[model samples]
Target: MKIVLIGGSTSSMTVAARLRRLHADWEIIVYQKESYVSFGACGLPYYLGKHFDDYQRMLVRSIEDFAKANIQIKPSTKVTKIDPNKKTIYFETSDGQQNTDTYDQLFIGVGAEPVMPKIPGIEAPNVFPFTRLEDAFGLKKLLPKVKKVSIIGSGFIGLETVEALGNLGYEISLIEAQPRLMARVFDQEMTELIDEELSLKNIRVFNNDSLVEIVTDDQGQAIKLKLASGQEVETDAVIMAIGIRPATHFLKNTDLEMINNGALVVDRRGSTNLKDIWSCGDCATSLNRVTGKNDYLALATVARKFAKVVANNMSGLKTQYAGQLQTAIIKVFDLECARTGLSEAEAKAYGYDFKSLIIKDKDRTDYVKHQKPLTLKVIMDKKSQTLIGAQIVGYNSAILRIDALIPLIWSRTKVDNELEQLDLPYAPPFSRPVDIINIALSKLAASLEEG
Candidate 1:
């Protein structure tokens, strides 16, 4: 059997590698639009911050290595069309040559593209989008020459780029259309902590403002950003870190099922509405474990896990993926923030009556050293008495303790007296007699009992 994959991203490469090991005899081919494949796009910020010098280190695998496994990788190629009836795919080669290929099964993992906001003079030379490897190379070349940069949007990439460029002595102006930073992922209280950290690092924040236009100099380089609030902020360049939409524009006018945002909708096994065709990645939609419905949670963790499920089903193994809780973590200067499952807003929107407990305590014993203030928030469904979501903000090591609570939420474990007394490991050097998680659970349990 022949398997053809479109878009050689994390999901595509993972499926290819797994399939190669499972079915040595099956023919596999990958068509990638970019010159590089199997590279970590997430590491771009670190690369920009000089955390690492070599750009080649971002690569996970080389073409020559995959060739040894009999996987044909066609870089600089685009899959233009798909005819599910004939199981045929039409692609354009790097040399501008049209080609056709047949596949027993096809996987779509085209991923997403950075949002280009609608604003006048945005096409100026100094404005850039920090998404791909090529973008990283271009930014690296320009970073030393520029002193001031205005980043539009305060989401993950936007905030990360702020730290990366700020570390290099660049005066950063972080502009956000929302009133609070990272509104989608963090609550107001957590966002306040992030804002404080950014202030300490000399990053200027402009919230509740929209970029109406990009004012350019005579040389056609971005000079300043005109905001809707009647403010013109001077800058050397701009980074469009607003957001991203699925890169499945080529799949339009076809019968393939997709979400409103153009992300392909697939089942738990990674099967789309059409037979013999599947999709998984940022370009596709997966189930939200907490909501129990299809959601477009575009994280590298989700892409990696569901890719295996797609490979298994295509390899004749019956595999099913449970879904995702949208677990994510990030570091901003001295503060480390992470969250899993649902948020208070999400729980309420999903029509669940929930109670949330916020706790502030010390991470470790006084004599143990490195004792930092830790803040944890837990959301529980009042009716079910089960954990629905959790968020943490604290020191580098302290915030990562959210790992223990994530599994409980993922499993929808009930928060009762028994759970409050969970036998978690404890040592003065690592945690208090009652760990932070246990304290949060105990507090939550007490609230439930008070009813």
Candidate 2:
């Protein structure tokens, strides 16, 4: 059996690795548009910040490694079109050489692309949409000569880039069209805390203002930005991290089912509507475990899990993905934040009668030196009395406790006296008298009873 995978993203590589292990005799081929494959895109900001000198450290595996397993790795090859009915794919090489290849099974993991908004002077040489490794490399080369940088959008990538570049001693101006930073991920209260952290770091943030135009110099380099709020600021360069949309335009007009943003719709088994065709990654829709609906979460975690499921199903081992909670974690300056499941707005939109409570407390006992504050917010279904969502923000490893709460939310565990008495470990250096999660659950229970 001949299998072909498009795009050398985390999901594509994962599917290839697992499939090769399961079916060694089958022919496997991967077409990658970039020169490098299996590199962690998430580490781009850190690498650009000089946290790691060697770019090779970001690569999980090399082309030679995949080739050793008998998988054909075609780097710098772009798959322009796929004919599902004919079971053939047409691609163009870097040299403009076009070719056709047939496959018994095809996996499309083209991933997502950064949203490039239409604004005057957006094509400036100094303006870049921070997405690919090449973008990071280019930014690193430019940062030495650049004094100030403005970042558009305040999502994970935007925030990370701000911190990364800020650490390098560059003046940063973070512009977000929304009223708050990370509006989609964190609640208003949590965002307030993040806003404070950013302010402390001297990162100028402009919110509720959209970029109306990009002012560039004669050299076609972004120099300033005109905001819709009648504000203008001089900037040395601009990084656009507005958002991403699924990179599935090539599959347009095909019978394959897709979401509004072109993310391929697939079942729990990672099988698309078309037979012998599977897709997983940022390019495909994922099942949101909490909502029991398909969602397009452009996260590496979802892509990796779906990759294995697709590989197993193709190897005759029936398997199912357990969906996702949109779980995500981010580090902004010194504050670490994590959230799982839905936010308050999402819960309300889903028509769930839910109650949420935010608790502020010390992460550890006062006896511990340098103890920091932590915040925990828990959302529980009013009818079911179970956790539907949770968000945590704090310093040190306090935010990581979200790991323990994930199971409660995933299992839909009911909030009760027994759950409140969960035997979480406690230490002066670690936690307070009662774990923050337990305390938050206890508060949630109390609120539920009063209602």
Candidate 3:
């Protein structure tokens, strides 16, 4: 059996490694557009912030390693098209040479690319996109000489870039078109807390506004930003971290099933509409456990797990992906936030009869040093009495509590006296006798009983 994998993304590489181990005699090859394979793009912001001086650390596996494992990696090769009927793929190499290969099975994991808005003067030399490793290296080299940096968007990458640049003493101005940051993922209540944290860090925020144009100098350097609200802000450089779209343009003309945004649509077996073609990762949509719909969750956690399911199914294991809750966590300065399952707005949007509650408490005992204030929000389905969503915000390790709620939510565990009395460990240095989760669960159970 011959397998050809596209993109050298997390999903492609994971599937390649797993397939090699499962079938040692099978032929596996990976074609990557970039010069390196297994690059962890998630660490790009930390790389720009000088968290580590070695850029090579972002590479998960060296070419030599894959070669030793009997898996062939063709770097700097861009796949142009796939002929499902012929079972062939055409690609262009770095030297402008075209080639074709035949495969019994094909896996597409091209992942996503950063969205570049169509604005005037967007081609300025100082403007950069924050998705690729080259973007990190380019900005890291340029930012030392630049003082003020303007970031467009307030999503995960946008806020993370703000924290990274702010730590390096660069004045950061965050602009979001929505009324609040992370408007899509987090509710307004959670965003308000995030807003407070950004303010305390001295980061300037512009909400309910968007970039109209980049006012650049004669040298093609951005000097100021023209906003939709008739506001102009000066800046030495601009970083566009708005969001990403699936890199599936090359496969548009094919018969493969895709969502409106070009994300490949696959089933529990990670099999696409076309036979012998499988896809997973940011380039594909995964089943949302709570919503029971295919959702584009472009997180590495989803990509890696879904890859395993795809690989096993291809290896005759009949494995299926269990779906995901879109669990995520982020840190901004002294604040840490984590969330899993649906938000309150999401539950409402899905037409779920849910009750929600928020509680504020301390992370540890009063006698414990460095105790910080912790806040928790939980949403439960009234009909089933099951936990549907949870959010946590606080300093130190408070966000880790979300880990406990993830399994419960995944299993749709009902909120009852047994769950309220969950025997979570407690120590003065870590948590109180009754953790914040217990407190929140107890309150939720009481509310359900009263109703």
Candidate 4:
């Protein structure tokens, strides 16, 4: 069997490795546009913050390693088009040589590209987009000369960049077009905690405002930023962390089905609309376990799982993806936040009759040396009394509790007296006898009963 994979994203590499292990004699080839393969772009922010010196640490596997496994990797090769009907793919080599390859099965895991806003002076030399390895290297090289740094967007990447730069003692300002940080992911009450954390760290936040123009000097370097609210922020550098869209423009002319954002719509088996063609990773949509809808989940966790499912199904194992909760966690300064399943906004949008509550409690016993306040919010479907969503924000590993809630949401476990009595491990230094999860569950149970 001949299998061809596009892009070097985590999903593609995972499928390649798994397929090689499953069938040693099968021909496997990966065509990647970038020079490096299996690069973890998530670590770019931490790398820029001096968390690690060697950039090679970001690579999951080297080209030589894949070569040893009898898997061919064509680096700096751009896949221009895919003719599903002919079962052929057209591509350009590193030296600009056009070529074609026939494959029995093809996987498109091209991933996504950073969305660069069409604002004036966006092309300034001092402006960078935090998406790829080169962006991190460029910004890290210029960090010593940069003092005041402005970041546009407050999504995961943007806030993480703020934390990375703020840790280096750089004066940082965050700009978000939304009313609150991570507005799409968290509720207003949850975002208030993030707002407090940013203020405590002395980071300036410009909410409900967006960058209108990047004021640059004559040398084409960013000097300041003009906002839509007539606010001007003086900065030496700008990092555009605005989200990303699937990099599937090359497939626009193809007959494959895609979402509004260009992400290929795939089923639980990771099969695309066309036969023998599959897609996963940031380039495809996956099933939302809670909502039962195909959602564009660009999370690495989803990509890793989807890759395994796709490879297994292709290998005749008939595996199906178990769906995802969009589970995510992040830390900024002293604050750590984690969430899984649906948010209140998502639950409402999905037309679920859900009841939500937030409980503020202590993480540990009063005798503990460092007991911090923990806040947990849970959304429960009123009819079924099952947890549909959960969010946690606090210090001292409070976010870790989100893991316990994941199974509850994934299994659609009812939030009743039995769940309220869940046997979560507890000690004075770790947590109270009644963990915050239990407290939230207890409240949710009461709400369900009252209705």
Best by lDDT: 3
Residue 380 lDDT (model 2) = 92
lDDT of 2: 0.92
lDDT by residue (18-68, candidate 4, tens digit) is: 999999999999999999899888898889888999999999999999999
lDDT-better candidate, 2 vs 3: 3
Candidate 3: lDDT over CA atoms? 0.93
lDDT of 1 by residue, 1-451 (tens): 9999999889999999999999999999999999878878889889989999999888899888899999999999999998889999899988999999999999998889999987888899778888899888878888778899999998888888888888878999999999999999977778898999999998989999999999988889889889989998999878899999889999896899999999999999999999989889999999999888999988889999999999999988999988999899988877889999998878888999999988888888989767888889889999989998989999947888888998898888998999999888888877788888899899899998998
Candidate 3 worst ten-residue window by lDDT: 135-144
Flag regions of model 1 displaced more than 4 Å.
none
Give the Cα lDDT of each candidate: 0.90, 0.92, 0.93, 0.92
For candidate 2, write residues 105-205 as lDDT tens digits: 99998899999988899989889888888888788788889899999999998999899999989999999999999999999999999999999999999
Q: Measured by TM-score, how close is model 4 to the native structure? A: 0.98
Output the lDDT of residue 360, model 2.
93
